[model samples]
Target chain A: MKPIIKIQNLSKRYRLGGNGGARYATLRESLSGMMRAPLAILGRKGRASRPELWALKDINLEIMPGEVIGIIGSNGAGKSTLLKVISRVTEPTEGRVELYGRIGSLLEVGTGFHPELTGRENVYLNGAILGMKKEEIERKFNDIVRFAEVERFLDTPIKRYSSGMYVRLAFAVAAHLEPDVLLVDEVLSVGDMAFQKKCLQKISQMRSHSNAILIVSHNMIAVRAICEKVILLSQGQLAAAGRADEIVPLYEKLMLENVKTETVADEREEGMGIIRVKSVRLVNRAGTEARAFDTGESMKVVVEYEARQRAVSVVAYAAIRRPDGFICMGTSTRLEGVVLPPLEGPGVVELEISELLVIPGYYIMDVTFYDENFEFRTYFLGRKQISFQINSSLPSLDDKYGVFYQKHKWNIDDVNVNSPAHR
Target chain B: MGLTSNENVSALEPAVTKQTATITEASPIRHTSYQVPDNPLVVIAPTKSWVALNLGDLLTYRELLYFLIWRDVKVRYKQTALGAAWAIIQPLFTMLIFTLFFGRLAGISSEGIPYPIFAYAGLLPWTFFSNAISNGSSSLIGDSRLITKVYFPRMVIPIAAVGAGLVDFVIAFIILVGLMAYYGIGLSLNILMLPVLVLLLTLLATGVAMWMSALNLKYRDVRYALPFLIQLWMFASPIIYPASLVPERWKWALALNPLTGIIEGFRASLLGYRNFDWKTLTISAVITLIILIYSAYTFRRMEKGFADIV
Candidate 1:
């Protein structure tokens, strides 16, 4: 099948300084500029000497029907710029994009919603702004209201609604857009957990219609859940593009590398040369250092530190965080009521887990050493210093829905079963 | 399974190999037998020259235009104590002030008609024109959120603002009708020219509004300069005075102001004071068309930069 969307040699350039970079030029400056160089004003060539930054450069890709692609990048990586170019909200500076059928872009929810208008009115208004015909909105009006779950207050002005209801109504209208190609930018990060889940379900349902969907988001879990293909962008260039499982991990590593450089500056200023963490290692049950582990396997974290002074009443803290900034597990010596001996020289601290239940993905460990009372001063602080991966050999354990996998047993009518009979 | 092998190969080589492998793998599945649908193909590229005014898109998005106009009319009177009454009150109170200052006190000639009715007739269209342009000039900046988030004909926003002014014009027309009855001035055959004159006024207002709105997006000086420009414009037109007051030597120049013909045409047709000045009306119509076409082109030229600058 032919690709639904094709982008060829696309690039976008933005000027850096002077009046050229200003969002809007004042008439005074423009008049003076014209006076200074009358010929330049006519030719519009005065800005050629200014420094320029390319938001996107030579990005070439094709998207087929029935495909959901994820665009993952750090901030200012030109993810949103590419979406804007495709949506035609802004003209490209070079190259072009060819699109088949109708296109809908949700760069933001509630694009044209008014505060004084009621929910019903805003639905029609916002739908029109999103390029939906009036008949189309009328046809799906009930489903939109049902999905939003705001039937009781449909007549009330949306300004009177709670923030959660407003977001649901806004996202509801956006979700009902039936275009051949859809561009979404971090719109899933709205509303409560249940509403977010409902939105994800609605988006996943769009795939069955064979529509091409492009999602640019910072939420790794959502991208991993719904996107079949993923592309990584760095500094306005395509870095990698492949299956979601492979590219998402590579994107996370790139993110970690960026974080490592930024934290290196902070470490030098705060280390104070008193004591610091020299190394952190993750080991398996066999006592060999390893970076990968299976679900329900025993794991150990060893922290080796050097102390320049005799430090007493020191508390050790460690936290395991997912790539999306969710803390999966946290532990501390103070919370466990363990006391450590005074350290005047290099020593090692070990944290052992009998069984690690985290779901299969990448994880980061943060270790810190605080003085007594867990305040005042820190001997060592390592943020995102040690990274590891958890794998699941069992196909049944390959779910990405939750943070941890709980151990459980199943029985039917008091009879033990290896798996559920329903399966 | 394909990803696993590709990963192993990438691990041995460099990162560039992974990109090529993914592209090559995805490119081989093209099906030549697949039939492409008849959907419209849109090309987005950098605009280099003058873009054609794709008025067909205006026809396609007519419903959005209606909704935008409806929203403006609905939200304009919200939270106000007087509601839609403010529409009639604006022109009514302006007429009263002019009657006091320019008619009763200054004894300005109203072409042998009652000063109040003649001034009210001119104020009806004048108020609409001023309101439309002042509001329309700021419409694009006011709807900046929509401009950046979606792709629609940018012309709809200013047109909607101008369209919403008609509702107020109709409401104020009722007062003119009541005043015409009190003066015992019956409708004449020339009344047929009323619709034509109003269309000319609308076209002229829409043109100026579109031009100013597009300029306002780039310079922002239009916003501050607009109200002052309107104030001076009212004095230049024949709103408070009759066109006959201008000496005959400068009557041709006075007709150059597009509102001069419309306002004079409104008073002459509605009051049966004189025959329609076809010469002035013809000039007004021609100038209105010129401004409309010129402004439409200027609007299209500036539209490509709105989403970026706004």
Candidate 2:
């Protein structure tokens, strides 16, 4: 049997050195670039002067029909560009794709829906965009409406819908597309948990009809659950590809490696410096690979460094960032009016941010080495940002069935209006 | 639709290997094999003039454009007080204003036709042009989500914007014809030119709309300036007065507006105006042709960037 989709020597190169495309290009520059296009096509290697960056390079792939493939990568890994080229959203710099049949894509939730349009109108519009005919859309209209659970609000303008409802209705149209090929990008991050689960089930069911599914995501669990095969991209090249479980750990390791190498500190670790911050790692009580923490549980962050000289009045601080990039909180020993004596030799310092009462989402630890005056001996040093997720075994009283576990207290009591005893 | 995997590709096309590994090597793997394959498909569209559209493909997608147009129409009137009635109301009220200002107040001649009927004829095409231009200017930005996320004919956007306005044009046209009957003006043989004028207006509006829409994607300030430009453009056309009011030499320049011929031709057909000024109408036709070609070319040039920048 032939593969349903075939790609050969696919590559997408984007130039960042040139202005960010915000400014118009000068005629001379444009002409020069056009003139040099032939030389660049000849594949001349750069000699440490003129350079180029390949957003994707030498990507070759084939997918047999009915296969579900997951694309995983860190930021700037050419995952989106690859999908764009396949979906023909953007042309690849150099490549070819042989598509077997009609293509349907949901690169994002609510991709083609107009906000001013009613849910019913946007359904038809978005369905047509996915290559469905009017009669076909009408045939699935009720099923789509039911799946989205927006029958009551179908005639309401989409602008009035919540983001989740907008996503659901838009996704319902895509789910009913019934195309031979489906492309979904990392837009699963948009919808609520139950809807995402519903979407996943639909995708799995859609896959059984010989529909090829290509999913791009940063979420590991979703890929592991749905995709039989996985691909990993690293710095515009194919890094790894295999079964889901195998590729995910490799991608994680690659990300961790990138973090370690790119994490350079402004201040030195030692080298005649009064005090220096070195390495930072998040560890559980047992000191294993752990990012999740429970409320009231002791969590340790080891900030290791070498002391260059005998120092006094040294302080340490850690700032926590929520997954949304907001700084949840930060505190320091200096703020507490306490300073530690200096060490004469190299020493590893560990700061325990114990009893970490925070929400159950990804959080980053930012370590700072400072003097008693809050002047930075070293600012944001030593593995500056390390992420840790909070995992709770049991939810608090208020949100026992919620998506995330949060600590709270509540009480339930029958209200008695006559509690005053008829006074 | 993306199969961005190499191992699967390797399973399909095995790379060439020349060197043989030593027997001690595990699995006796080859020494070296490194080669990058060229893209197999090339764009070889015909360079011939007037590439015949694949009507089959267009027909297959007709339902899409139809749904798109319908969707636009529905969304336009979904929450209105009078709904589709507003479509007729807008042009009627505008015709009244044009009659008050350009007809009754200014004493402008309407080729001896009723002022309401004369203004209605001009307002019909003008509304289409103005509405198409304004909506078309920001159509790409308004549908950035669609452009960035999927692949379709980007032309569908401006085309849909134009098509949806036809709903309003037809509605207002019925009212115009009703007023014509009320004014005791019978239809003339020149009315056969209505379809031709409609085609020209569609092409002309589409052409300019494509240009403005594409440019608006890059420079969003175009979106802000579009309404003001449309209002200014309305005055520049012959909707307020006849083209005969302008001098002959400058009248040549006025024909360059493109809408001059369409509007004057519209009124000339229905009112049976004798001095239809075929020479200026022909010049306007030529100008519209040029604008159409130029706008399509500009739109194609901007098409590649729409998915990225939008």
Candidate 3:
């Protein structure tokens, strides 16, 4: 059988300091640069120049029909660019792609939906924008409306509908687009859980139709659940491509490899250099390194650091941060009026908590060493030195509610006999 | 290491060797030999030279084009209280302003025709052209979400914008017909060329719009500069005054503005009072063709970066 899609030698280059570049220079800068061109050439060694950065380089792949490939990468790794090129949203700077069948891309839902247009009108409009023929939309109109569960308000303008309702209707119309090849981005991240599950179920059903699917998402669990194969990208280059079970773990290992104690600190790893944080490790109550923890369990963090010189009135502190990078809480020995004496060499500080309060998800560790007086000179901070995962104790409690898990007691008291008499 | 299995490595190695591997070695593999020899390949490369559009692909996506046009038309007057009446009201009011300022105040000549009917006839194609240019130039940026997500002929976007303007042109054309009736004018055989004139006007508008829209991706100044450009363009065309106002020597120069002949042609066709200037029409047609071809080429060249920058 013929392959559904093939990519060959794809590459994209972007010029820095120009329009749409990282610096986002305006017309004024360009005009001034033009004026300085002659002088800049005379002083060529010191002149600032727009450099080229390749977003994607030399990508080659073949996807057969019925195959689902998940593209996983860090930010700026060109995962989105790869999908954009495949969908022909952006032309490849140097490569070619051949597609064997009708292709549809759902990069976003409600792309062209107008607030004043009725839901019924928007369904057809959004459907057509997603490459659905008018006849196909007409035939599937009832099913789309049913799936979105907006039948009661189908004729009403969508502006009055809640945001959740808007996304539901948008996803429903997009779901009805039956193309031979589907390219989906992180559109599933929207809507409620039940609606998200419905969309995922619909996507799995779409796989049985012998169509090819390429998905790009930051949600690793969703990718692992749906994709058979995974393509891992690192710095605009293909790092690995294989089965999801094999590649996801390898990718995670590669991502965490920088956490080893042997590496030197560099830029992007924050520190004041008066004292350097050697490592940050999570431990269970039993004092053993814990790869993962369960909610409501006691935990500890060890901050190992080395002082460059003998320093009096020093303190050690650590902050726990959610996966979204906001600090959840901060604790310090100095803040609690417990400061260490003069320190000359390597040392370790252990901060303990009675129970971990974060719900199921990943959390980062940031350790800092500073003077007792909180002076700016001796301040040292390690931002996101390490990360740990938390598992939910009960399957019923999910991460969708919020990040922190609160502890509380629940009870029911019966006042049965007095109720009717009092009334 | 487990995920990077030998089989996976071997599966990925074939592409590298296929170019150099001998036929005998490849034929022995049953799986490789069983499938049809080769799938059609599409190689993407940067534009090295001028390129023409693929009409067959455009034809296949005709339904999408129709849908886009309908969407533009529907969304234009969606929440307005006056709805599509705004279309007629626009040109009507503009003609009134011109009749007041240029006709009564400035004492501009309208050949033998009445000022309102003359201006309205001129305004018909002018309104269509300006609307087409404005909407078409902004279409790509307006639908940046779609452009960055879906694959379709990029030309369909600007084409649909122009197509949507035809609805307004038709709506406003009705009022122009009424004006002609009130002015006691009759349609001549030359009116048969009205469709041809409209087609030329659309081509000119679409061509310029394609160029402007494509450039707008890089320099957003096009968005701000376009309205002022159109205002100046209207003055250059024969809208408020007749083309005969210009001396015979410079009429050729004025014909260089494509809309001059198109608007003059609209008057001659609908009002039946003026003779068609064949030389001016020929010059306009040639210039329109050149602009259309050149803009399509430039548009195609710039389309590659649209998704990246947009």
Q: What is the TM-score of each candidate against the true structure?
A: 0.77, 0.69, 0.74
Cα displacement (angstroms), candidate 3, residue A7, comes to 2.7
- Tens digits of per-residue lDDT, candidate 3, A1-423, equal 567687788898776655454342345665787898888889894244757778899998898765678898777899988888877777767877887766778888787787778899889878877777789899989878887889999989888786677888888787777677788888878664576777786776555432678998776767878887899998888889988878876765555454333233321347667677777778896889875788777888877777777777777777776533346777778769886878777887788877877776666676766666444323343332566767775676655566677775434475333211112
- Candidate 1 residues lying further than 4 Å off, grouped into runs, are A17-22, A39-45, A264-423, B1-35, B38-40
Give, for candidate 2 chain A, the lowest lDDT window spanning 10 residues.
Answer: A374-383
A19-62 in candidate 1: lDDT tens per residue? 64577877897798778677776777876765788999999999
Candidate 2: which stretches are off by over 4 Å?
Answer: A17-53, A159-163, A259-423, B1-59, B78-86, B224-232, B275-279
lDDT of 2 by residue, A150-200 (tens): 999998887877666777787888877766678888766655456677777
Model 1 pairs whose backbones collide: none
Reference-based lDDT, residue A112, model 3: 78
Clashes of 1: 0
- How do the candidates rank by DockQ, highest first? 1, 3, 2
Better of 1 and 3 by DockQ: 1
User: For model 1, what is the alpha-carbon lDDT of residue B59?
Assistant: 89
Residue A274, model 2: lDDT of 55
DockQ of 3: 0.20
TM-score winner, 1 or 2? 1
Cα-lDDT of candidate 1 = 0.82
